[model samples]
Target: MTNTENQARPIFPFTAIIGQEEMKLALILNVIDPKIGGVMIMGDRGTGKSTTIRAIADLLPEIEVVADDLFNSHVSDYDLMSDFVKNQINRGKELLTKWIKVPMVDLPLGATEDRLCGTIDIEKALSEGVKTFEPGLLAKANRGILYVDEVNLLDDHLVDILLDSSASGWNTVEREGISIRHPSRFVLVGSGNPEEGELRPQLLDRFGMHAEIRTVKEPSLRVRIVEQRSDFDKNPEACIDKFREQQIKLKENILLAQSKLPNVIIDYSLRVKISEICSILNVDGLRGDIVTNRAAKAFAAYQGREEVTLNDIKTIITLCLRHRLRKDPLDTIDSGSKVDRVVGEVIGDV
Candidate 1:
């Protein structure tokens, strides 16, 4: 589908989502600070994981991009622009820009490596002496969200490629000595049912936060969710209209959070304590510490605060550190509970 058509598609309102607050918060914080890395959501099937993701993407504010740019090259930021865009700027060419909804590229479970990463046409290069490059899902996902459903089943090599590009904020394609590179920065979101399988520890640790969701057990809440879905299915437009005000406020809050994230700071003592928890838990690397700090700051910014609070860290600590803990086949305690126990020991009833 065309970009316009994709943006125009009706999506369930983010504010209207009834449960899965942890998953929603993780997503919002990532949008506020992409530096937090991204979120990995694990839950039961039909628990609204995909719906919640789509809602957040729909709720995001539009961004300006170079007109007709395949990579959605940032209008003014040099780091976010493609090499072609940079060359244009160097030549003093005026850039035409347009505002568009944030792209949300879904990665199919069976996608080939070449489809995930753009391919260079070697035959065209030899025939015409000009490299023909075709941008793939990674290019479309730049400056937006790249969501992978059933991620536990994705190939390990593909997961490695995604993590590498996510870390480097760029994708490079080379074929027959022809090479192309472009910005591929995006918030990588992956969701899956735990019953199928678990992602390898190393790959899971790459995600900034891990949100665990479950099917709603409360009958009343379940009924409400069902009713809401039925309402939307009956008349999507009217249902969206009902939550229009709330959606607007949420969108505004996200935009403000993004603007305020850079100024949000965590106290030195708190930083020390965060690392202490990671160290005590034997978390493999400094990623747990770094992501926790960033997630805490993003949480504070989302709350309209300029300084990180102990409460903010307490709220998101589990999401940041749970998946990073070394799993013991013998230990039955939950990873999230283990992280929380460490937080209590280190932060002391905060």
Candidate 2:
């Protein structure tokens, strides 16, 4: 397809999406601060979970990369480049650059480990008497979004690989006496229906924030969703054009938030409050504390504020701590409610 045609293929605008406010907010906050880790969404089907995620691609700003770099290495990521690429640069060749969309790759449920983590180029090694490496989904996902639609259904081994790469920001493959390591940093967004199965706790905790999405229950809201979606389906281009201005503005806001994040400050009192809430919830580790701080700061930045506030903490606490709660077999309530109750008890409900 022509570039124009490709660009013209309509996607539901991020601003035009109906309900699921928590899911949308979680995504936006992650864009503002990817270090908050990634978001896991569990809810009923047809709640616009994947639709909301796909719409986010329209809002992403383009990134600068070294031209022809297979790994999408940024100018600042030179040290992380593979040896051959580094050697070429060391020979005084002027590095070429290009502007491309930040990658947003979908990891399929049936994907193999080799495809997910890259494999050795066996054919080339055997035919040419030279070793070569092939990049995979993890490579394509570098500095981008790696989305898993049915994350709960992923195999245990792939889950472990994702967890390792996520924690370390690198994917290493060692086979046939060749070891290759490359940057694999990306915001991981996963969605699944709880009715299918429960996500493993170890994998669950890997997500920085968790949001529960529900089908729109209000008739008025439901009607609005149907109408907007109908308009888009009838004439996608026109619908997209109508929201073009708002989409551009959102993109600009995200860029501004990113630039302002370094200046957004977190104070000692908020830190203590985060620790206290986590402690009250009996959270297992400091991940809860760290994600809470990062998410609140990102929210503050997104709202053009200079510092994190108690309200910021309250706004994001549920998402940060909900999934981290230790399972209580005797407790009948959900983790989200438990988190809210603890927050209300500890911080007095901003």
In model 1, how large is the Cα lDDT of residue 255? 89
- Candidate lDDT scores, in order, read 0.90, 0.86
| Number of the top lDDT candidate | 1
Q: How many angstroms is residue 330 displaced in model 2 relative to the true structure, after the best TM-score fit?
A: 11
Error of 2 at 216 (Å): 0.5
Task: After the best TM-score superposition of candidate 2, give how far the Cα of residue 93 lies from its true spot, in angstroms.
Answer: 2.4
List, residue by residue over 173-268, the lDDT tens digit for candidate 1. Answer: 986576889999999999998778888888888999999999999999999999999999999999999999999999999889888988888999
Stretches off by above 4 angstroms in model 1 are 1-7, 122-129, 327-335
TM-score against native, each model: 0.95, 0.94
Instruction: After the best TM-score superposition of candidate 2, give how far the Cα of residue 18 lies from its true spot, in angstroms.
Output: 1.1
Q: Residue 45 of model 2: what lDDT?
A: 91
Lowest summed lDDT over 10 consecutive residues: which window, candidate 2? 326-335
Residue-by-residue lDDT tens digits, candidate 2, 1-350? 67887675577999999778899999999988888988999899988988888889758988887888788887656644655567667887777889988888999999999999998888998999888888999999888888999898999799889867876778999877889888888888989998887676666877899989988889999999999999999998899899999999999898999999999999998899899988887888799999999999999999899899989888998999888774652322255888888788878946
